[model samples]
Target: MNTLALRLFAIWLVVFGSVGISLASEFFSEAEKTIIQSFGPWPPPLIADPSNSVSQNSEAISLGKKLFSERRLSLGRDLACSDCHAPDQFFTDGTALNSAHGRATRNTPGLLNLRWSSWFGWGGAADSLWAQSIRPLLSKEEMKFTGKKLRELFSEDIALTQKVQELFEISVVDQSDEALFVIVGKLLAAYEETLISGLSEFDRFNVALSASDNIGIESYLATAKRGLKIFIGKGRCNLCHFGPTFTNGEFGDIGVTQFITKGRIDKGRYQGIKALQSSPFNLLGEYNDDQQGTSRVRTEHVTLQHRNWGEFKIPSLRNAVKTAPYMHNGSIETLAGVVEFYSNLDEERLHIRGEKILRTLNLTPQEKKDLVAFLRTL
Candidate 1:
């Protein structure tokens, strides 16, 4: 009932609102801040693989892009790299097993961020990207192309042969079939190195949060934030899915069944190590461009043991929402299924010496929903 009283109330409201906003700025706890900081500044530095001489060469990338889509690289001349790794589907074929040749045992992973990977394939079979590129071409379950077949193709295709000569400085007539095969792999790897994933909503949030700017991160959903808290906290997901690319880039057996049929067992990294060591195309082999042999250290000293029996490479979670049919066997069909698998993890199924990092999460239904929400932002 008085002008002075009304003015005083209005001033108090404004002051209280300002104080509330100030307090809200310190929303994240100290532990949460550290976790957020570790996630990134977005677009991590490109890792260099010295084993491939043309890893970053522009001409090699161009030739590789052309070659990646060339079906003639396969035995049947019907399957190309793009057959399993289609560009429109975020590089994944969205299938459990690649059936371009026959049905591949392992799931076809997306090719994004291969430059940062220390190893390639589900089992980490290849130490170098170039070597990994060559494996599928030679595998019976994949492209099934021999060195002789590839050599013949190169000799016959005048334009492709000329491009190879101009780009790699190798004469098809003079080079051995194996050497030509390796050269093609190197070019394919050069193109794959450029397939980096773009920034996501999570990356933007991390950038703003790292800078201590609360206003800049207003677009981030509250449910997603709660889910992120669960991910870095109780979910223990950060133990494997950490760093800028959201993966440790290592192998683990999280209790997924590895049996292909009745008697056959997919002895993942155990077999991978044997294959990598025996292969002539391995980084430690003569084909490696790195004369210094610095990149061969991982290959030379890699430990093989019974624990690696069912292990598979921990895939990067970037664009994981887009690439479905999760896991090495593609047994988990949805993101929700993946979350449920972790939540109700079967410890008995794991190897006796399997990773000690995993355990039953016992997440509430709401918590599982929140975690999935957070993953979608990636």
Candidate 2:
């Protein structure tokens, strides 16, 4: 070859190699690498709706907070909202199953980012926050307070009753306990709307991402980054648990075999849908219709299906690290164990019905570790 051609080829190779090395170096930089490593690299707005209308008023929230701890609202003045949902333990009592004042049929979920939830309970029965409150109050195992008893208690406590009346902007109907129950439910709903947790390490990472601030996010996104990869890839967790709330908000069978042992089985959303449709405390109830307008979105599209047998409400992962004994039945003990359960999933125990949903994730030990590390950061 000619000397001139050889020289030109050598110069081109040097320039190309230099550019490639520079790009590779930037990609693997300490700060850049660490931020990329953090779990759930997505922004907070992607996880939950920050501007939920339920979080608007302070007075309503305060009133709701006060009523939440008050036992007078219950049947025998024995139970309060705090009985099931405790604040110190991330707003959930952290029990596998919650015993109301007596027996509980299901687990107590953490009230972390409930405003983002479209439905309440394991069955997605209640459509609104106010509607969710009524279930426990009337449940046989829960508060078990009725109309007659509630009215008597409200009448006896003049100051408390007056407070309720003033806060709700309506008087308690003299004879029926239904009106008082509705008021208290609404107040409790208002209070629960204020329990949103502030920005965590995950939130900070999102901020860094928006401004392309690589150095600022590196430290916070450590284990979380590694976990995020496992979650999206081998862990296969992102299929059901996909959004900012770490949930697609769809019901799925997570391989809990409680119903299999029982023989008859708890027909999850199927029964729940019928009960919610016929409920008096529902958003479409006469009480709500009279108080609010008829235009409210209540239990409209909620329906029952065969696949909903073991289905439960998909929970938010805001204070997920603190709220232990995961899932609807609280079957899994720790976050690490929960990840392992999904990793080496035993299909034998899973009653998948007609749908081919829960399958063995086939994750390695290191992959499980990475997934657990990521969950703790949430």
What pairs collide in candidate 2? 37-225, 38-224, 38-225, 39-224, 39-225, 47-244
Count of clashing residue pairs in every prediction:
0, 6
Q: For candidate 2, lDDT tens digit of each residue in 1-378?
A: 699998986886587756644543454446544534443443334222212223345666777788788787677788888878988887788888876565465678888767667678888787667778877888878888788777776778887778766765667765256666767677677778667777677666656655556444454545566676666655566666766677777676766654624565666676667777887767666665333443344355556666777666667766688988887777788988887777767776664452266678777777677777777776
* Candidate 1 lDDT, 79-118, residue by residue in tens: 8999899999999999987776667888889999888889
Reference-based TM-score, model 2: 0.80
Compared to the true structure, candidate 1 yields what TM-score?
0.92
Show pairs that collide, candidate 1. Answer: none
Per-candidate TM equals: 0.92, 0.80
Q: Which runs in model 2 stand beyond 4 Å of their true positions?
A: 1-55, 289-298, 347-351, 354-358
Error of 1 at 254 (Å): 0.7
